[model samples]
Target chain A: MNWMRTEMERPGQREQFQDALLRGDRPAVEEMIRQELADYPYWRDELLGELTEQYLEGAVPFSQLTVLAEAAAALAEHLPPVAVCGSLEGNPGDTGRNFIQMLFRAWGVPTLDLGADVPADHFLDAVSGQGIRFVIAAAFSADDAGAAMLLHQKAMERGIRDQFDLLICGAKLTEETGKKLQLACMDHRAAAVARWVVQTWKNR
Target chain B: MEKQMIFPANRFALVPDRDEVFAWLQCDAGPCRAAFEREWVPALQLLEETMTPVAVCAQRNANALTVFLTIGKETEKRVSALFQEERYILGSLLNTLCDEMLFQMDSKLANILQRELVSEHLYMAERLEPRVHLSPETLQADFGSLQSMVPFARVTTSGVLYPAKSMLYRIVLTGESRTVSALHDCARCDQADCLYRNRKHESLREKEKLPERELKESTKRRKRLVWREEIGIPVLLSSNASVDDNSEVSRFMDYFKLADPNDAAYGALSDRVHLLTC
Candidate 1:
């Protein structure tokens, strides 16, 4: 229980963990998290963190977002009072964006969805004088992906970037690009975003 | 070999109800109204051009009967292409048209099946719809009888029909006569508050214990659930919906529709609402 020794993390266990997460089997995730009390941090980071990385890289299929959102919903109580989310303007079929909002909704997280193809300024205005903790922007098109970065850039230029967490998401986002732009980038999936949000909240 | 009957390209097109389709799209008026006004006729025309509505009916072992109806894969693709192109209103209208078509097709087929069964002196005593009356095991075990006709559709391991728009039904035939439309499979459920029974949130909002006038919007009443049939999306409303409590003829979108009546997305809908029920 005191950060002792356990069997090494293996590809077999990793696959099983991912299958459980993607299937929204929280009990299995909880079981694996508590599999062995030994080296608790190692197990949590390796299993969950690595899974988030896989999700960010677009290794996970787009259709699995709901189950993945369900997996992340356990962290609901840890969520902020309210947040704003939307797909960048003019992107048709806001399925991914809706699913992500639904992810927040699953935990009864109060989200002001600006609807698909939102102008970045609407986001800025929604949080003004409001208790918003973060902004989750989804981009379904290559153009909207640029809009996400643009939103981050505008938030920074206005010196309002520090006001709330700005999470830009697209399949195109990468750790390399995020670091290069110095923007808080998110994976296309909300599950990982939720996890990142919780981690960021804890760190804050 | 199981004998199969496939109705291909029959002049059996059922024109969808315009108001119902508009209601499903949440676009009875306003910004979408103009779009819907401009596009519905053309959209219906396009749907008719693209959809290959088909029905398959088979008389199974003894007197068992089964029927599957679909507007075909290409019709679904056409609707998907519209959504993909971001013609949200038109695409949604056409999308709901497909469902209305399937629904009309189901009723028509059911009647046809009824007539056939009656002539053979067999009564359609009991009927089962896939998700409604049939259990997962029953759907999986029973789908084999109809699968060969639908090359693209199959019951999943968990028993959801692929190409979700496709409809499946099985009608039980018996020697004894029974009323054609009897209380259905819902009688079997034990859960008191099923969404299926309570989908009429508009009505329930009236029957809500506390009148809307007494409840302060900021008091934050416990959230209630409402569903729009065939809208292809979910609506999770914000709790700030205490103003303009026009529950009658209010679309699901009206609950959280922005306050400014001039807002592009939902402006006309909220403003045009009257006391009449649609």
Candidate 2:
């Protein structure tokens, strides 16, 4: 439990913010930001810098970006399907699943939540049995790429690899690896996913 | 079934309080305190000067220090063996440090940036956009004085506290690196039929200390030879060489297979090992 805390922002705060974001409570984020800003006047710039870092580094994608504006607008809405995975790189506390949920909501897709370290069989059962349209494999290292690869293999074995659009996103995914596997590798950018989904859907 | 074998002196329980333990070992009272103090300070100083490996450890878990100490069996055996007279003082001192409050340790946040979350930058870039407006100055001012803290506690698990019976203790250190590089080579090796051939760490030379000629012959023959327990596991070198099935080391590796070594199920492997290793 203690190790869990080291992996991310304080769990309580993170959870609250996540809840607010999911509820589409833009005002809450704005208000919380304002209060935090007031609490640490000196850290306002740094906090924003950190937030920007999160955004640019793809922790908070464009779809999730809407949460910022929506917070400003004071609207709260629920999001779509999500999946969290442990790091392939051995780094702890990645929140790509939550970010993806936010992005899927922006695309008007209802995302299911399947948490981290989930096995390949579980993923297979979920996708085929649960009618999952979008599959996002998130990892933080090259070793984690195996999880995504397993999914690819499973989908192909089940003859559904081409049926549903699949995307692999993470810090661990390499250009060569993605090209080798023919996976649609994206960083944390929701817009990139959005673009790909739109194009794939149109082509379909 | 067996009256869980207890050691002669509950050497582990001597210093119940973790903080007192750390003070004795790192500062004064430990069995190897003097030597460690003399060597450690200098090593730390040198490490700081070069900054080759990031000192990513945090104060959160005083236990992590002890856990790190036990990472290598040879290191543990050497330290544990020096447990008498002034050595006892040093050992006790070390034990004291092991008992200290992990949260009290200093967290090198810079090291976290450099080592622990090495690819955080890449994660940010892939998920978020490149340029964004930030009231950077205010945020810096906010967090400037707030010290970076580590949250994990390094408590000794049930299994790790037992006193040693054998001269050497078994230490299991696995990583994603080995499975990716070495296991792949193992799969490709001609000796795929060997039972213990599938799992090996990268770099046979590093694992196996053999001359070039023996190494070549070993590679060609694919003879899975077992080493005696005297030297620990019989290490086969050369990318991912097969382990002799009859070796004690192979037996030891087999005992741990309640969980798979490669792509363990549901990350449960890490959690189980954490509990067992402390």
* Top candidate (DockQ): 1
Error of 2 at A28 (Å): 10
Task: Name the regions of candidate 1 deviating beyond 4 angstroms.
Answer: A1-204, B1-3, B29-31, B182-278
Cα lDDT of model 1 by residue, B35-144, tens digit: 45666787888887888777787776545667777777676666656543434445556666877677667767767666666787888755655433454456666667
CA shift of B269, model 1, Å: 47
The positional error of residue B75 in candidate 1, measured at the CA in angstroms, is 1.8
How many angstroms is the interface RMSD of candidate 2? 23.7
Compared with the true structure, all predictions reach lDDT values of 0.55, 0.35
For every candidate, how close is chain A to the native chain A in TM-score?
Answer: 0.57, 0.54
Q: For each candidate, C-alpha RMSD in Å?
A: 24.0, 22.9
TM-score of each: 0.42, 0.32
lDDT per residue (tens digit) for residues A1-204 in model 1: 233446676557766765665555656756775555343333334445555566557464322343444443433333345678776654433445554564454333557767656877888777675767778877542334456666767777777877887776544454555664465645655666666665665466
